[model samples]
Target: MTLPDFRRRKAGNQRISFVTCYDCAFARLVAQTDLDCILVGDSVAMVVHGHPSTLAADLPMMLFHTESVARGAGGKFIVGDMPFLEHRKGQSEAVSAAQALLRAGAQAIKLEGAAGNLEIIQSLVEGGVPVMGHVGLTPQFIHAFGGFKVQGREDAAAERILADAKALEASGVFSIVLEGIPATLGKRITDALSIPTIGIGAGPDCDGQVLVLHDLLGFTEKPPKFARAFGEVASASVTALRAYDEAVKTNTFPTEKESYA
Candidate 1:
């Protein structure tokens, strides 16, 4: 879907379904499904590459995956995730990074934060780049928060997130992602924004929901609490491999029909 269609979903009252994938294979596979959006999320730092956190992901890595996913998307809208410093340092850097991501085939770029990132978001949008803003328990800010903790539990913090979302909207973000917040707060932000509010751990009140493809398929080693596995692909794969190994060891795998010669 295009950004306009994605934005329209909020007023249309149509719930969206977004899934995150980092490689060309999954992107192509998901594009064939009923998903409304595909995100080349920075969470790949952990899910794909085995990094401890998103902080380990960089521009080159994100670019490589962005291009790969784009190749497989078949013209579907793909949001390339901006790694920490790509937008944090300054507007010029953010623009440069965004340009790279666009060239790499991302229809839009998503950055974490609102208050500190308003300038970057504004500059990008003004320069003809569409952006998606992320707020509430930003992973890039994990150091500051000490971990991936839920946010907006208290009145003051909830107000801060609301303010952040407003600032981001004013900065020209077409949509926003609300992560790790309460359902009430998620609904509050969704109601306040004209654009769509996509939730991860923020709950069912959002305009849409997104989840990592790995977690959704039960391929992740330790899935997060918010993730629900629809299929146990990992365990099934293990079992199949074990059966193959046993077949080979027992010399029962190659029957007359299985033999080419």
Candidate 2:
């Protein structure tokens, strides 16, 4: 289904859950669940490629992961993130990047920022490509924002955040992802918008929630403070890998009964 349909569903008070996936395996697992969307986030820079931040993720890397997720999504809606610098070249560049992602099987595209992005978003929307708006703690602007700090903490900042949220909605975005904002501000934005607000560190009052898949699985050695581990996959993965190594060293694998005749 189109993202607009999903937005309508969300507006009817249905909570949507989005999960991040960087590869086909995780995308397959996500498809088995009831997740409404899968975001091929540039956070893959940190979680998969061992980068210190998302700034290190380039478009080719993002497209690689986006295609992998798309292959395993099994028809689920996929949103591919426009990596840093992909859209900074202007509206035409943004459309080209977004079009490449759509051809790569993404149902939608997400870009950071609010002010400089309205034209890009408008262009994409006009071309029948759904756009998911992301603001508050936009990792792409880590350099400008001066590191991964909490946004909307001050009065002026909070007002700007609110204004940005409204402006994004006015630009025909299907939904907005509010990240790392104060709970009160998140709640107010949620209350004000017709489109659903998907929160990452925003709060429980948002219309829906999203988390990086690795963060939820505890695969990251140090996830963001707001991330809650729903499973000990990290520990389990280590144990399983260790066991496999031990079995191989001991010649315990490929047993007689386990081998093909």
Among these predictions, the greatest TM-score belongs to 2
Write down the lDDT of every candidate, Cα atoms only.
0.91, 0.89
Report the lDDT tens digits of candidate 1 across residue range 99-189: 9999999999999998778877888998989999999989999999999899999999999999999999999999999999999999999
TM-score of 1: 0.95
Worst 10 residues of 1 by lDDT: 85-94
Model 2 clash count equals 0
Candidate 2 lDDT over residue span 1-261, tens digit each? 466676686668888888988999989998888788899999999888989889888888888999999999988889999998788897778888988998888989998889888987888898999999998999988989899999999999999999999999999998899999999999999999999898999989898889999889988778787799999998998999999999999999969999998
Candidate closest to the true structure, highest lDDT: 1
Show where candidate 2 strays beyond 4 Å.
Answer: none
Candidate 1 residue spans exceeding 4 A from truth: 253-261
Each candidate's clash count: 0, 0
